[model samples]
Target: MEILRGTVAANAKPTKPSFVSYVTPEEIKSESPRPYTPKTVKCPHLLPGEVMFCSANTVVKETQDDLSQRGVFGTLLCTNFRVSFVSDEEPTEDTTQLFKNKLYGQNDIPLSCVDHIYGGYEDKRKLITTGSLVKNKCPSKLIFHCKDLRVFTFVLTYSEEKDAKMIFQGIVHHCLEPKSLKNLFAFSYCENTACPEKQRKQRTMMFDCAEDWDLDMKRSRGVCRLVTENNNFELSPDLPQFFIVPTHVTEADMCQFHGKGLPMWCWSHHSGCALFKTSTLPLLPEDTIAQAYMEKMLTAVAHNYLFSVKTEDLSDTLPTVQDIQLAYSKFKHFFLIDNTTDFWMSDMKWFSSLDSCGWLDIIRQCLQKALEVVECLETENTNVLITEESGSDLCCVISSLVQLMLDPFYRTLPGFQSLVQKEWVAGGHNFLDRCNQLHLKDKENTSPVFLLFLECVWQLLHQHAPAFQFSETYLTVLSDSIHVPVFSTFLFNTHHHRATVLRAESPHSQRDPLNCPTVWDWSVQFDCRAQDLFLNPLYTEKPKHVKSVQRSRPTHQRQLSLPTACKTPPKKGFFKDEADSLKKMLRVKRISRWMLSPETPHPSSATREFYETWQRKPLDHHGLILPCLDGPSVRVWLQRYLRWIQEVQIFGGGAVTVLGKVSELQGEVRELQRRLERHGGSSFSSSNQQQQRAIRARTGTSTGPQTGGSRSSVRMSSSFPFTTLKHNWSYKPAIPTSVLQSLMASGNLADKEDDADPESIV
Candidate 1:
């Protein structure tokens, strides 16, 4: 080893635990010529091509064990890849620099292993101290959370303060680097070398999604204990066009197994073809209209696409042709029962077990399945249509999720609110029955389907924090308002219902707080549960005002940097103002239409009033419109939505195409390697390094699965041709057929036929 040790004053014997070291205050002062000037350490053990960032005099502290012991004084080195520290123990010449001194023991940590870094003084902490109490310089320290769930703390004093800021910023910058498939799969060092087995397992799990799934085996085994613990509900039989929602698909799929309203889209290939979600016919035999409507809907789906799925289940108790009215009746009763239990029991002692609730489980299952359908449509470029007994409950959930996932615009606050309105509210997800069950009956056959949907959306908001405008608190309050009877959720089944209720009431009544409650009323609830539900852990506060840091910039540049209309705060209670504006716009449009055609008979007063009253307000803020939230929330939502639009509509296609190219390149590289192994060296042998580098550049593929070794590191090409990709600034961008069909291939088994007659069950 090439060792470069710094001068040390003491010759104390090394301790049993090699990492431990002790330095007295007098010794530390003697080592530093100036009290404020920290001794910098240059690491001699830097890996090949590793660049040193900065170094400082600090103390190494172990966080996990020996909590009461003081930190060991040392010289810390920060590099592009890792942080290393050298403690003072061995004696050397006083004239020699710290970097030349002999060290007792070294502690090194790789940057890739770090999960989070705290600078010790966050904005929230600074706000707590009054101006008089606040110090000119706060104590500097760094806290690191590692991927292995280990914590590291380093304390800095005197001259080390500046180094703390630099090191903290450097670590954060490294963490914020654009993550790729390779970085996600990269192996980390346990001590000094990589952990291979752990990396292999994680990478395998990631690739498992592409592998063929055995639904029957999982069903027979009852593989997931969580699913078996809940209920004896059997998995839906694998129909010709649709598969059962599997219990063992992923660990996250635990809460969503064997629940009702679970028809799923079936696709032989991931082509951007119209999705066919095959489901059981309705359970009720009273009415045949739903069945007829289903057939007509299926026909329309088929007519729109060249190839569509047809469901054929061999063994199942569900009816083939269901009656809509009776099916809806059962749905309504079930929904009501579930909602009542959730509303009451959520505040009760049994709230912990709510995840296992049969109704909640069904909602979770529907949401999970719906997300799967959406992934197929959006990421995989497949079009999907759902089929269910009444084509309402689960159908509504799946379709809503599909729309939200596929459209970047829907991910915005107003778009999300409008999505709920269009899907659950207007699309008829049995809100009336659920509300009636919650309001009228205390027990039996109630469901929390709407609340479940809210939770599902919350999950998305949690995962993609930037994509949502409203907080979890907003959703929780809206749900609680259903029980309170004042909010629109209780009195109105849909937007139309709410509009009707509003129009019927006098303007004076609408203005009063008690008489006319909007969704905003939920925010005023002071209950512990209400407060808890309102808090969103993932909401990132954006800077309200941008600072002009550069005064010397050109006039035009400064003008451009000024906050745009989107950034400007709207008037408070903007929803009310917007609503009034919409009403006026509708009236003007009506008047213009009347003036254009003089020969048309004059419309009735009631007809004119109804048109004016019932018209759906135009969606603004980039086609997103949140109901109760103000401009700030909507603005935050809009920012996220616009970014999402750019990602999905503009950059997303290129990523997909790149992914396809990478997949092809990997296959080619493997084939060539196989050929090289079988035969003697050829012309390809000379270009092997180039080929391997290209593969690594494109995909983060491992060199050998058995050893879990990588051939090359991930290389992110900054010049990736994003500008060459076609751009669409619209909220809804058109998808090309070729792009959609690029990755389509048949991997699933062919559809099977059933012995049971199609219409016999109903």
Candidate 2:
């Protein structure tokens, strides 16, 4: 594709009209541009593929390693439009239902209908902790609610550490002309004699053609192409030409976009921005963390100027810290609030003194420069929602107090560690302590903010003031005022346990691809979240990802105490008057003094009522609430985990012991019977005589020997014989004993019936 000097390849022949189509280089060289010191280029308006003069797009490398492309995609926050609707406050069931119904249009918005989204910030004058303004600020939202409304969103995202911000707000305002359908060099017929394939696709895009700017030239930005355009390029001509348009626009000229011959045209939007800020600290007295606080303050303060949808690069014109502080010094006394110039202005007066009182007078003379930046907003009917910021809201108020206390430093000749800068040693009074002295003021009847201010001031004095016994007392007073977080979220919450970066090969390394652990210091953040708010210290074994521990929690544990009496609002929202009865039931019943008196007292109706009331929810109860070390409470609970494990061990051990004992008892019984059988009628003394008699009688007859004392003794002595004889009628033990002779002498039968041969012999 070939690029012409200024006009598209619409001419049939080098017609006379070619002279009238575009401004020539002679005309460009003759004119000068507006609002410029540097960074301004000659505005070019050439059609794609027609090369003429000024090698603007010729690829070139610069002084720095970064290739500075002449054309990079950028956002322009220049649009201004309005739309109105009701804003829903908190997301409610009914509100959600309504939102769903309204999300899609009941009918299409015709090309004729025009819609918009624009907002502005107000001079909140929120005194910040820092003396500096926030950096890389973006606009906050104020949504619009309507019966049939839908909004397309654009976001610019990047990291402060990386010094980058991707912006996408400019495309909203750019208009695409709907009339011109053809003549765009889409796939082209470049009859340029310089080309082999004379008719080819031209690189001059529709967006680049109208805007006269190209952004693909930036290395970080990579490649991009126009997504929405009509396909209409003729591929014939007996002549030659080129196509490749420049991509950039001057303030005076707007883009003339390609169209589809309809009432409207479509343009795709995309963007991002990268900035380079030295990784070095710039403050003379303060540290980096303190500097970050100032940046936040600036963001909160300069909310309005940043609301423009067009994302413009203001880094070139942005003032340095010193210049900004000077602006504050100049503008401080001009605006009045309450009866005083206020601490912010007073600090401004001290930190950066105006060269002359006249210069100061200009500030005093001016009405309100802060408001000038903000007054563009028109609130929509949409509901506003509030969520807690990631960091402490309490810190914001504290920072303002510190700034107020440091006002005197602004005026001192040396100025915020100038002595340290000169001598390389800290000598001036500490800024942290100097700022906290404001707490000495009487705090009675102070507003919430005023009370917080007093607390913040007191704390600073305690931290940096001369070591004194009174400081602890001041701390006690401060503790009564604010509930500060225990740990710093940035230190512990974002980074790894240790401060060193992890390498992949080290076993302790946290650089596993799965976790992508950070190398930041996590101690401050961990302790703050753990020991301060929640007692379980946040322990991270692997920097890549910290696994959360789950302690068994009671299902009905009461989180807070309930109110003593009912004071429900008529139409309270969900959070305003939630159920408190459930909170009371979780508390354990306690034995009161009345129940433990010296004498047993008779039951009273009131006592019964008290006991019945114990049935109420824990939070609903009125007495003996647990106090936390900080604001969040530590719940005391009894765990049965260890006891359950012990019980299982004991039961299992006892069962095995009992089974063994039973087996041993059975074996012992068998051994005793065997011994008795082996003994028979021998190995016995006089006591054995009874055993012998019993054996002789039992062997003779089953029921024959009804024993007297001697026979019973004999039968009792024979363990095995007794057991066997009870169940069966056995003949004899192995031989008859001499005790049988004694029984016969006593005139006992002695089983004569079985001794037939003996009787014959007798």
Candidate 3:
């Protein structure tokens, strides 16, 4: 007690919360001075101020520091289905009980449901003792939160002579049925010290994503009940959800949907996820031939990688997070190495899975073929087969490419042990630039079908990695820029790209006025009888339309097809809205609350392109109800201002864009006419004409190819367009600032030649 007290600031009273003063003992050093906090909601073993109840001599903040020979992470599997048989109402209770006892493992014994337990153990002193029974008295079930937003009830008793801890692994990754535990969701956080920029971004993103997702869920579930009683920011303590969702329906609706529905306001806004790049691989046009095999082939692919992907690493028989991260890392490297082995160069189960037994050889062959031009990647390669038919068998190319792009970034996430040496970030970005370069230099060496594989790989990396380097700059400004749409277009322009996860602040002026509600309208509001809530009464009448539409025609389509080059999309919710009027009637709930002084929406750089900033200064609040008005009509002055800004942002951009195009056309016309006079055999008179003729004659003479030509001879570069260039300067140059200042004596800071890298161009 004395030791803990002495560490506190000398002037501070003991009554203060530990956070205001240093509570960590001086003898122990923290991992990082900055003391980073996770922005995203996460449940690490030792969150700040968390304490494990103990009657020991002393307890240390670090669980590992206090315990001896303990695992940092743990897993425990529950095998007590018989415990639930008391629910006589469930008819399956008997069958479920028999099924539980009948369960068998690989050896086919009537196995114990809980075969193993994972957690930390302290062998030195049995700290958890009830009446000195030592470890034997430890409770098998201690309640705590999990990173995956789950609270499980474990029933196990500990028996250790010394103090011990059971490490709780983030997720349950054992038993074939564990995959069903996904009504639970997870998010990311930084375990790293805060000073690292990468960690900072990741931590912030995790929190922001969580917050935004929660808002979406609340809004969608019903008109969200987020408004505080008196405009308080302190969220209502009674908010029902623990984990964030895209949107959430109300409790009754949630129970009805098996506790699932996009959380209101939790719209990732993915319905119209802006296309950064068009998919080069369009949806395979419908055909009876491909449709018949599509499911079977897709099943084969999913089965080929038969291992279950856990949300987090469990410590039992299942592989750890570190292992999965490593496997992902390997998957990325496969893209870089030209002659990398096929079996398991990237994915751990690549060549080892039961279904992949015969597929590896075929994939290797595909890789060899993929390295050739677009035509060669097809099953029947011919120079003329450049259409979709040519590259019909594209799965192998996709698989290999996925390996190359994804593995490296996935290696950077929290559970993975690989240290992202500070120097590697630039190298990672350059990898993509380099790929573009190689592809341009030798078009036949790689093709877009393979690039789709690269995109798939990136998709995996984005999913697993904590930090995605979507943007970079030397200084002045930084943007969360994905220019993914740009790179993706180069892959294939056939299918719509689904990299639909991005949110950033943009200017308020840029948002779509229509999208902004004048009022914070609720998602739905209805009240009749709370008792018959879950039942759908309308199912009694079956619609005749379903009977007539048994065949596989595109369910509903626009009367006309789009241009052959792009897809034709129906501009409404393509997914069945369910049109459940009875469900809708039962679910409409009212606005829980509204603040008279509503707050301004936070600005986002990325989402602002179609975002509108709304504030309720006075009239817009539309208190309780307005006479004969659906929404309050603003006085003439403000209404005009709102319309003006909205129209300018949405329509002004179009005008400026059109003006710029016209100017460009004018400049091009003048340049072309000048070129015609100089090279298009235009007859001219006078001395200027004579000079022009001489230039034309020289151009004609130099038109033929020259051997061993100098760069001054003006030959077109063979490399394709837009690949990044690498400079190979002969001399190491001194900084211009240093040279100029020194040479100027009484001083000027300016380059003698041109300012190569403009720090301030203006």
For residues 654-760, write the lDDT of model 2, one tens digit per residue.
Answer: 31233234334534654675689577753424322332232233222122323222222222212111111111122222213343353356474444443233223
TM-score of 1: 0.28
TM-score of each: 0.28, 0.13, 0.18
Query: Model 2 scores what on Cα lDDT?
Result: 0.21
Error of 3 at 758 (Å): 66
Candidate 2, run of 10 with poorest lDDT: 260-269
Candidate with maximal lDDT = 1
Evaluate model 2: give its TM-score: 0.13
Best by TM-score: 1
Arranged by lDDT, best first? 1, 3, 2
Candidate 3 regions exceeding 4 Å error are 1-363, 376-762
lDDT of 3 by residue, 1-762 (tens): 887677675667657455554432423446868664422211112222122221111121111111122211222222211011011122321321100211111111111122122222333322221222332434433332211111223222331212222222211222112222111111011111121222432222221123533433332222223321211212221122232311122334323323211121111111121000000122357655444332222222111111100010012222222343333333332222111122111222322332223222222323322222111111111111111111211422322332222122212222111111111110011222212221132223222222223333233232322222220110000000011111121112111111111011112453521111100011111111111111111111112354355234543211111111123434334323532432232211111111111452221221121111111112221111011111121111111111111111222122223323443454466467578868867554343332232222211111224312212212111110001112221121222554334445634434422322333322
